[model samples]
Target chain A: MKTKKHENHTYIIESEDMERKNEMLLQYIKEKVNQLLQIMGTKPLRDEELNDESLIAIDPIGIIAESFEQVLDHLKESNRQLQLARDYLQAVFDTAGVGISIIDRDLKIIKCNEKQKELLVNGVSQIEGRHCYEVYCGIDSPPLICPAIETLEMERAVFLKEVTKKGKVFQIVTSPLRDRSGSISGVIEVSMDITEKKRALEAMCQSEKLAAVGQLAAGIAHELNNPLGNILGYAKLLLMEQDTTEFQKNRLEVIIEQAKRGSSIIKGLLEFSHQKMPVFERISLNACIELALRSLSDEIRSNNIEILTGLGTVPYVMADPKQMEQVIYNILLNAIQALEGKGGIVEIKSEALNGSVEVTIKDNGPGIPKEHLSRIFEPFFTTKPVGKGTGLGLSICAEILKKHSSNICVESEVGKGTKFSFRIMGGVTGNV
Target chain B: MADKSGINLDVINLDIRGQICPACLLISLKEINKHKGLLRDGEANLIVKTDHRDATRTIPDAAIAMGYAVFVEKKKGYYEITVGRKDEDQKA
Candidate 1:
């Protein structure tokens, strides 16, 4: 009986211990579930709604796990869209027509596109992470017109209307790239090549100036021509008298000679101002060239200049033969004068091409200067001494060719030579 | 039982009109757990109509987290939150 009593008490104590452990484990589970609910941004779990047994049965952890999976799905979708946007922007940045470059506040180049490389960067040169000024402007330091500095200093967009770099004109626009907090971190530079546009504008201005000068020249020439002719006529009439002294005869001859020179100058001005429209006819360009050379043959021979001709079998071009010969004469005379009596080669080549006859006149003499190339066809723009030339030679040639539906071109180097080429229509189809 | 619609639409409605935040959340979760399989398979919809204002916010959030579509409707004096799939509103 005593052993039975001891065993029963021991069994009761073990049973109580087991109940306490179970109660503690249930409390721990409740606390953990409540913590998870709080993290889900919700109110804590109520003990009344979920007793220890019900909480375990519902498996709140599993519910929260599935909730997180949905959240993950949404996040992944957002990331995918963001990546697509980034790729689209990158494509636009690369294929833009104008040069584009990205630079940091320190002026270090971050990215440069294909046009930027073509416009500013040289082949096989490293530019990434280097100073932008060094690569773009080819200088050790930033230039006074550096748009990067302007953008950083102004903290806004900067547009430089005209910038000359690498001997080409550009219009530069720079915009600041700011971070989320609105502080500038870098800059985006856009450069457009406007070199051709600038040259075209200059040519337009030059033509306007030429038109104004031509009008003034015509007015002066008109006012002086009548007086000059009368002076020459009276002086010649007095020279014919028999009672004149030798001294008076000498003075009359001088007056007549000077007046004739003045009249010739006036005639040139009138011809330039009122350039006649061509009376088109089927004329041989070779015949025009032959006549011009024949007229200047004495000068050509005296200067010891060699005439090299490669006249191909070309058809007759529709032009005014008189004006065409005049054009050839002016160009050849200029070439002879350019040789300065030092014997040189003048190549005359003609060919039939694309239903047009193209002619080239080249001289192996001291070429025109680099700066005077564009102004060579302008009236009265002369490099010759004041009394030596009238300065209307090339300009008048240009005018005559214009009437013939063609233009003149001259290419010159300082020490080498000059080449001039122009084309006139020749095929039967061109006649219509 | 067939309603006036004459289709056997399974709708379980829990009316906790006087409840507040946490109690509303716990009761909604218990009901959702009880019918998780039915709700996913579009077989049943769980409708919890409560007067507690916070329940509208909390209940819908928790249901959506559990991968169930939820719609909340405000009636005369109480907010009703429905948690299920397609045709859940028509069934309610």
Candidate 2:
């Protein structure tokens, strides 16, 4: 208001005020625009860039608003891509075959896949946030050997070949889950169900043991035969001398009888070590069973026991008739002897399955003890009293089945019953 | 659209070589606005060749704020700032 324009220039002073006021408004506009740009994260505008007349026409707010829309759009797109990646990882985690679980530092289950839940808990509902040991072994606290604990302590991966829980076997691998700074934060555990593999391994070990034992028994029998033959020949010659006294004759008779018993036992051992020659001929296992039952009819009747037979329509198995009949008779006689005093019932079933004939004989007599089940097929392993069994009955049965490229399995529960089952091929036996 | 190499592209060249900060930023923004549709659709690239080193920073900052993919390259006598849509794998 007080300027040189007012010095003897009062007439033009109002226009000067207007001019000054216009400059002030332009400056305000520039300030406001630059402020907007600063908020939008960009550099301030300069004076020479745009004339005051065209400043508002540029629509800087609209330009920045549109640009912000792009920025927001980019952020949303980034979020969408991240969600896609997360979903892909979740799908992979859920679909993996191995049981997978993530546990926190305190041994709490942070996450568990369906496979893991199925394996450990048999798919119990809502296991997350629970203690890992509680879910895995159904116990309150961690067991003596825990993979997650070891992984966290060692800060590395640990693999356990076989771990038994709930009577089933598992192979577990645990790795440390580390934080960004490479410090162990938790554990990621993976488990594979190896119960069947463990069973197969055990069966293989049993087979190898039996094979070695058979070889040893064969060698022993071969060595004992010559000496036993000499003993029997000399005993017979002394008895035939005709000058021996009654006491000497009686002693020699006892010796001959005992030698014969020893020879019979040795014969059984040799048969168990190597099965008798089985002529591979087409034979009806059903007929073999019937024949064996008829021969054991008197014994079965005298024992006051009932015999049940369920013979299905089966193909002729490629097995020798005599050997197959002997197997059936031996297995049946064992069952009858087991049920002699108990007068229990015996059920026999036969069926065709998987290009082979299967036979199962179940007895209601006292079941074989658990301790003796595995050794029952071993030669000279019997619970029968002395002079009753040579312990080679079941062993010979096992050897015969082995020669036929099969095996006889026995399932027993003490005081309940015992079941013996085996399979024989009906067509040409191509492979063992 | 097709250049000498027969690739589908329309290059909008902005030579802001002796200018510094605010002016460099304003000029790059104007070019981006002028070809907003094509650049956003990945059909055009606003290639700014600048001699001032500050333009390399200011121009790319503004261009990226508008959701344009930016790549800064140092040439013999100038810096080339390429801005476009992130529609393809590209490097300056």
Candidate 3:
């Protein structure tokens, strides 16, 4: 009888321990649910009260255990769904070319994809948790025209806005984020680096303006041609007169020279305005360059610039010979001008590589500045002071080559020299 | 047998498909206009192929916006819309 009583006592203690464990688990679950509600930005649920009908005369242990089990199951299922959604979203973000970022209501970057990180850090570090303005716009606080804040307040998507930061332009769009309860939660910003696009647009605008100017120049040149011919004809007539004095002859000669200069200027303007379409024919590029050099013999000799020709045997290229000659002439003239009355070596080399003919014209003159390198092919962009350079030389050469589906690339180092390489499509001679 | 009251007119046929957006719908209309003279003369038809179902439902609305009389029909996997002169539809 004594041992039986001890067994009962032991059973009671063990049962009490199990009940306490159950209560502790319920408390833990309740705390976790509260935490989850806080994360989801929702109100927490109230615990069972003594006067509550749902809990009236109910066994607290059973109720707590069953509720905790249900909560656990729900959390597990929700966590699985959340993980799947996160994976799908991450996949979309990674594959999208445009940069994307999510900012909380506080303007702190809550999430950012690879492209966003690439644009903000230039392929460097992670940008998560950083303030959007500080990291991207380099501002301590958000700007007055903050798209993210506006999107959140208006609860609507905004169109792309062009913004410049750190000398680079970006096109950014923002959309409001809504929670399950249809409340605005945050903002999603999509940005694209539109600097190159903007530059291309500006270039096209400039090209259109140049085209208009070319038309005007053509008209002016046509009108000036007739007067120039008259002046030249009269000057020659005066020079041939038998009764003309030495002073008169000298004056006539000066008039003739000025008229010739004006004629040459008109010719250049006509060439710029009337760019003939390239008529491609099979021709040896080496022969063309050699002939161009021969044509420039007088100018090259007067400048005392040494001309070195490394004319490698190249495959015949289908190109307009006259246009190619003009291209070479412009390059050689530019090289001579860069020397600025000083003598330097101009090397011309040719090679056939990878189904293309590469012709390089290198000059040992004061090289172009780094900033001016890209703008060299832009119309009217010249380093030479006004009237000294029309700046159409390189631009016209580029256009001519571009018509032949060819390209010209320039590489220069300050104080060193400049090398211009022209690549043309080679004729397929049945040999790869 | 004094007079025949009912008169039938020929129906114009036009097919447009592969419409993914409003822009595509507009482009299809522009393409149809290439045969506008023939349609006016009641000689030729406009045919297009599209793969978007939502755009099919929206075609009538688009036709209304352009002040066109259109008849829409649904086949197994496509929608065909006919747009032409209103008086020429009496033969259908």
Lowest lDDT 10-mer window, candidate 3 chain A?
A: A49-58
* Candidate 3 wrongly placed segments (more than 4 Å): A1-60, A63-81, A101-110, A120-169, A172-190, A199-203, A239-255, A428-432, B1-92
Minimum summed lDDT over a 10-residue window in model 2 chain A is located at A2-11
Q: After superposition, how far is residue A154 of candidate 1 from its true place, in Å?
A: 4.6
Model 1 lDDT at residue A261: 77
Model 1: residues with Cα > 4 Å off, grouped in runs: A1-70, A87-97, A113-131, A138-145, A153-156, A164-168, A210-220, A231-265, A297-313, A340-345, A351-356, A387-391, A428-432, B1-92
* Superior by TM-score: candidate 2 or candidate 3: 2
User: How well does chain B match by TM-score in each candidate?
Assistant: 0.81, 0.83, 0.57
Would you estimate the TM-scores of all the predictions? 0.65, 0.61, 0.59
Cα lDDT computed for each candidate against the true fold? 0.81, 0.80, 0.72
Residue-by-residue lDDT tens digits, candidate 1, A150-195: 9999998999999888878999999999999999999999999999
lDDT tens per residue, model 3, A74-141: 46766898999999988999879998999988898998888877777554365778888888777898
What value does the lDDT take at residue A163 in candidate 3?
82
- C-alpha lDDT of residue A397 in model 1: 90
What local lDDT score does residue A396 receive in model 3, on the 0 to 100 scale?
Answer: 85
TM-score for chain A in each prediction: 0.73, 0.64, 0.69
**Model 3, TM vs. native:** 0.59
